[model samples]
Target: MNSDAPRPSPRAIASLLVLSCIVGLNTVDRNMLGLLLPQIQQEIHISDMMLGVLMGPAFMIVYSVCSLPIAWLADRTSRRGIIVCGLTFWSLVTAATGFAQNLVQLLAARIGLGMGEASNMAPASALIGDTFGGRYRVLAMAVFAAGGPVAIMICYPIIGRITAEQGWRAAYAFMGLAGLGVATLTLLIVRESRVDPAHGKAGTPVATQAASGIWRATRQVAGTPGFALLCLASVMVSVNFGAMLAWLPSFMVRLRGLDTATTGALLGTYKGLVGVAGSIAGGLIVTGLMRFDQRWLAWAPMLFCLGIIPAELMLLFADAPSWWHIGLAADTLLMSAITPCLFALLLSLLDSGLRATGVALYLLIFNLVGQSIGPLAVGMINDQLSAAWGTAALRSSLLIAPLSAAAGAALLLALAARLDTSQAAPG
Candidate 1:
């Protein structure tokens, strides 16, 4: 692949769009649990710690554990098939979640959901890299990344309202059924891009070379000091994000005195829109800055992380609803900006054949520290503080998120300082 490859064609763009939509649906199903957490807690009579288990460890453990094997398959097989099968399976499992009558059943369904989602990021990202070469690849990925916020924007109001009227179970079933449509479309429309010779060679009769190549690729990525710093930063940022996703809505409902509908609407419109803008802006800014100095990729996210800390602090302490909303919007904008830049930087750290496996490893570490532990830690903290803080326990528990962002900023700055600008990866 050429670094100066031509812009993606209409067919490529269409495929990207469909794949992005699938990504969006995947996010919507995953995040809907957060939106409906309060209701589910009320109905199931589970404690905060139990809710954290369902939202965090139960889902992330399976999601993280399965990612590598799935990514390995994706690297050697049809990426499209992996995505379609995962999508279809997860969607159906999400519907099964709606039928759960107890916490154990819900946990089981969530575990299945995690297994299904395990097939997504590595393959989807690999596909994007193959479809959109050169500088446009970053922008295309930013578009794909926008799917999460977009899903929130579209699903929040609809799911929130449905949960208010029809119940949380209905929201799950509806989202699950809707995903089946996306799965069908993906199966029909998304074709696999031509595999690189390095990847094709993995399928050769000699298994030793394939294993050796994978080992060498892993060693190469692991040996990169800058990539190590990036992963540290990613873990910190993911901690903040995971904690927020698990508890923010509940915080609003409890501390800010907003109902679920109002909370969803505000977040959907304000946070979602601002986040989408930030993602696009960050991609453009980082890519443009890379034209002058590649270090800007790490620096941009560092600055964003530093900026987000104050916004998050304000959100935690704000007394007025207007002030709280303002803080949330600002925090979300800065936080969202960091993702595209971080992902682009990660892609630049390794060879093309290792991209999917590299991403899976990144996600594995990210999910283990961030998704599996972050929310659970917060929940445990909230429970511990409840006696002293009462209704304010959740608010106080969230203070750790900003501290994580601060650590992330420091890590990013370290990464920027160490980044070798002249050793840019090939497209």
Candidate 2:
């Protein structure tokens, strides 16, 4: 390698990692609530529905509504500054969550936390998309995306441990402090990417560029076949992803009789390490295969989804004891590995100009509907059936995940079939 050819600046790498940690920490905070739910509920006198509201509507709705505006700001202002301020705000809120004396206080804090978190991804994504070009962009995005899993690995277990020893409140306080530190680092390290001079501000203001309203950007994206299909596929992916994130640890404890710490470790290992490997591998593989054929966008998801079926079945019926652990592990790996390809496929659909909005929309549907609804629905099902089947009900609820996954596979396959094989990027 030509070291003299101006390698990616150390500052850039530091910024990216800090951005990654910021993302990781955010997810960690989110997942900590789930991991410590039993304790939090018992202490705070909340119901499962309240848990749903805290993790779901309180957090996601605000986050989803705000993301576009924040991304719009990123388009119009400094991506670095937006991300730094966003991180600081959320970090403080995450800490404040610990001090909540009742549901109202916690709900308000989570909402504030949601608002802060909303700013992190869109601009950070736009920044990474701008900083690295083409194939490396996919890889860099994959590395940054790994923040989800890596944060899960570190944060889940840490929360589990803290909840065991210092209590959930202490865990929340610790996470908040961690977020503050990361936000400070982001302020110092992350530099804004150079914007195209022709555009009035950060690049082109997404709203002004579209003659129509903000909905216009979404409508334009929806009109594009590949982009539309990718977004649809993303929602399906999110359903299963959400189920795993919010409930699997709980499921393991209730169904398999694992302790909270063990459940966290299991999820962190399979979902974090294995899933992250899959994400990075998916991005790199698609980039390499695209050198030969662009159809890899469709092909990767088709193949990855196909690979998950058996594992999904294993998870659905793992109570028989013979295949429980094996099935659980495989499902974990399958879900993790599939994500990188899913993201790369979505990115491939948009022109460079629309990537931020495109990514934001992808996230909007994926998070708002899939992440927000999937877990709550599953939880509702478990709660409803817990009286009839005891703890076995949670396992039954997970069946929805794989069934949705299969439907997602069908959607991606149909989309891939329609893709033009012509060797050209969209102009």
- Top model number, TM-score: 1
As for candidate 1, its clashing pairs are none
Report the Cα lDDT for residue 410, model 1.
Answer: 93
Question: Model 2, 159-217: lDDT tens per residue?
Answer: 77877888878888888888888878887788865332333455555534772356676
Tens-place lDDT per residue, model 1, 1-427, is 2356676777788888888788888778887788888888888888888888888999998998899888877877789999999999999998888999998899999899999999999899888876666578778878888877887888888888999999999989898998899999987788766323444554643322433455565665577557777888999999999998888988888888888888888778865788788788888887787887878888999999899888988898987878777888889888878887888778767566667777888898899778777789888998899989997999888887998999999998888888777544436
Model 1 lDDT on a 0 to 1 scale: 0.82
TM-score of each: 0.94, 0.89
Over 4 Å off, model 1: 1-3, 194-217
Task: Tell me the number of clashing residue pairs for each predicted model.
Answer: 0, 1
